[model samples]
Target: MASAQDAGRGWSMAGRCLTALVGGYAAAAGLATLLARLLPVARVEATAWGMILSFLFYAAFGLWAFHEPRLARVAGVIWGIAIVTGGAALLLGVRP
Candidate 1:
């Protein structure tokens, strides 16, 4: 019973959900790795701090994914952060 427009909208919503989950998690992980490396603390403390902050990053990314009006923009920002942070983490010698 759905019209074409409805189907398209459904797909768009689905894309947003996918981005929020996967992209958000990726961004969070990258940020955590980078922070773990950068924090001026003992290794154990820095890693613990990174793990705590990663949850915030993920939640913030998820909220932003929903708040942005354009789907492409949402994907770009989320994925862009993921790539940049991940790349930086790798460059800093953070092990996978």
Candidate 2:
């Protein structure tokens, strides 16, 4: 049987992994925005919702693939939040 202490430690590590994924995604998105400002991006005919969905979906999937259960769930939540934020930003027409 697994020890309680082991379980606790596992949970903590998983939490850290999830945190890292979400944090990494946010950092990446910010960097992308910066790059977009500094350099011209190829013009695309994509809608705001489409961009948001792709960004968040891939971010969450990336996180899940990189780690175990608890971490995956956390990353998933973070991606979800980002998606919602993206929607809000879209409605407000807030660029970056």
Candidate 3:
């Protein structure tokens, strides 16, 4: 029922939206972790979660771009989970 253009458009929108959210978080986290030493009071690195959040964010975008609602939903859930506990894991060095 869907045309190729429609599919492509859908995917593009998904990718754009997902990237905006996830990419923003990843950038901020990276800056915080890497720049922590800028101040004498350095904060703990949230580097552990860096990989998962970055991965899931792009994965969700890619999945949604393909119009795979099921997979996109799964990825969205994972993204949510990652955001919720990602910082904790990074702080504690516990892999999620």
Candidate 4:
């Protein structure tokens, strides 16, 4: 029988995992798209660079999500970056 404390801990961990995976992916994709659009190079090369950097972005976001103590802060920062970068890329006419 799981106590309330244990249940809360489980939920918290679940939230952190989801934020680190899904939210982190979103943030990485958004940043990659922005980079692809903004790099001053040939289209193919720019896109390649973005693709290469996306892995680092994901890893960084995942690490930060786990390192943060507050779930709300983690969610807000990760999702906020995802939305802002995605929106900027869209506005800049970068096709995802």
Candidate 5:
């Protein structure tokens, strides 16, 4: 029973780390692609700005993942943002 509890705790920590890394990256990339396509500036300038802003997004998501009380909720929010931004980028034909 004690071992089972420890295993569950370990799995929870691993899940949080995975969400912070993978989910954060996906969300940031999707946001960057959407912004790059939608920005009114020249393509080169917009893309550069988007890329710069994405770092902030990634950092914020990483922080939120650890701070949030529920790992599942954090994962859900990250995935939701990723899906919406990704779909919008696709619809806008953003290539990156």
Candidate 6:
């Protein structure tokens, strides 16, 4: 039988994985949209760069989620960033 500590660790790992997958993607998408909208470069170039940079953003955020000691704090910060950036993109009329 699995010990209580092992089960708790498993649950924590699952939560971190979920946060990295979902929150990372959300944050990356929001950042890309914001960058594409705010960049001073040409629209095509801006969009291209934004899309390219999104992969890096996702990876970085995923790593951060895994490294964080507190799952709740990680989730809160990641989701907060995603929500704020998404709202900013919408308010700025980013269409992509």
Query: lDDT per prediction?
Result: 0.91, 0.52, 0.48, 0.93, 0.89, 0.89
What's the TM-score of every candidate structure?
A: 0.87, 0.34, 0.35, 0.88, 0.86, 0.85
Using lDDT as the measure, the top candidate is 4
Per-residue accuracy of model 4 over 1-96 as CA lDDT, tens digit each: 336767888888889999999999999999998999999999999999999999999999999999999999999999999999999998889443
* Tens-place lDDT digits, model 6, residues 1-96: 336767987877788888899989999999988998899999999999999999999999999998889999999988888999999998978454
Residue 20 error for model 2, in Å? 3.4
Return the TM-score for candidate 6, rounded to 2 decimals.
0.85
Off by over 4 Å in 2: 1-3, 40-96
| Model 3 agreement with the true structure over 12-88: per-residue lDDT tens digits | 55654564466435444543343332324414444444433555545554455345546455456545554544454
Model 4, residue pairs in steric clash = none
lDDT of 5 by residue, 1-96 (tens): 225648887788888889889999999999988898889889899999999999999999999999998878998999889999999988877454
Query: Higher-TM-score candidate among 3 and 6?
Result: 6
Point out where model 4 deviates above 4 Å: 1-4
Please tell me which model should have the higher TM-score, number 5 or number 6: 5
- Give the Cα error of residue 30 in candidate 3, in Å: 0.6
Instruction: State how far residue 51 of model 1 sits from its true place (Å).
Output: 0.5
lDDT over C-alpha atoms for residue 92 of model 5: 70
Residue 78 in candidate 4, Cα distance off native in Å:
0.6
Candidate 1 weakest lDDT stretch, 10 residues: 1-10
After superposition, candidate 1 runs with Cα above 4 Å error: 1-4
